[model samples]
Target: MAPDDQPAPPLRRRGARMRSAVLAATVDVLAEHGLAGTTVGAVARAAGVHETSVYRGWRTRENLILEALAEQLDAAVPLPDTGRVRDDLVTYFGALARLLATPQGEALLRLSAERDDTLPDHRLAYWSDRLDRGAVMVARAVERGELPPDTDPGLVIEALAGPLFTRALISGAPLDATLAPRLVDLVLGGASAPKPGA
Candidate 1:
């Protein structure tokens, strides 16, 4: 039998729908009440599921929140893979900036940060996991001679995103499409430009 002749697999589509419902409801609860408001019972009510169902899938509110956050992140920003490091980074963080400006995104960050005093390790782990890939890409650019080998990728990421975040949250400025690419250009120039002696 040819591959095309094989029967279609079972949809199991309900799993996806249920997961999405939980995540969407979680986002709403987080936005309205912050992290403290997203209890298992609250999420269950919001998702139209029995409290038992939530416990069956996730034993605790923290676990549920983490899973929901991961799902939300998957939708908010796609890490760019363009050959140009600067362009790719700018585009990536630009998307992130836009997300941060949204109601859900802002609420998520604030809620996460609000818990930092109690769970500093969680904050470090979360950022380290999320940022590892981006750091690798910048490091690769340096290895390829596209950037200074000694440059700190962490610092590079901060430079690219710091201004945008500041502008959005602190200065009340826009992360307009035009401004994002321009910021990329400025950072890329600083990273790759020949030094005075070299």
Candidate 2:
């Protein structure tokens, strides 16, 4: 049999590469076109894959977009364990602010805010998962006594992140270098664990 006649690589091996390419393409499309303009055919063309493949893998454009956004967030904003709650939060929110300042990040922020009645539950689930992931920073702070035991991790995260989003998506304010530390200070001031016997 000729080499040309050889069958293509097994689906499992090719699946990984295809998945990565498709996700990357999805992000690029989202950044360039926004959520309303992104389509499976566009992503498939960008990724050099068939439209059916994307449909088969992600089931819908919403799912594809969500997975792509999740991947970007996980990579761009990491959970820090610097042993000091202030430092960890500063570092994490710093990364988040930086990401939000970028065009791609701005697109993601807009996408997250979009309201789709048909996918309200799915959107809530997506936000819930992301908030839960970010809450780890607060959880660690509480464990280390850097924050009060009763501190609400999700609320703390929201408090720190809310202004950043507002600045990026609403106020047209700059996400400057000092912003993260300043926000962290503001939130942590009220949330910090009190000094012993004081």
Question: Best lDDT goes to which candidate?
Answer: 2
> Where does model 2 exceed 4 Å of error?
1-13, 190-198
Q: TM-score, each model?
A: 0.79, 0.86
Model 2 has a clash total of: 0
Residue 119, candidate 1: alpha-carbon lDDT = 50
Best by TM-score: 2
Kindly list the per-residue Cα lDDT of model 1 for residues 1-198, writing each as its tens digit.
Answer: 899996443233247777788778998898888877788888878877777767777777777787787678657888777778967787788788788878888776666556545455666677667777667668878888898879898777777767866775568787677777776776767647764335
**lDDT tens digits by residue: candidate 2, 12-79:** 32578889989999999999998877999999888878887888899989889888988998899988
Give residue 173's error in model 1 in angstroms: 3.3
Model 1 scores a C-alpha lDDT of: 0.74
Separate clash counts for every candidate:
0, 0
Cα displacement (Å) at residue 63, model 2 = 1.2
Give the range of the ten consecutive residues with the poorest summed lDDT in model 1. 6-15
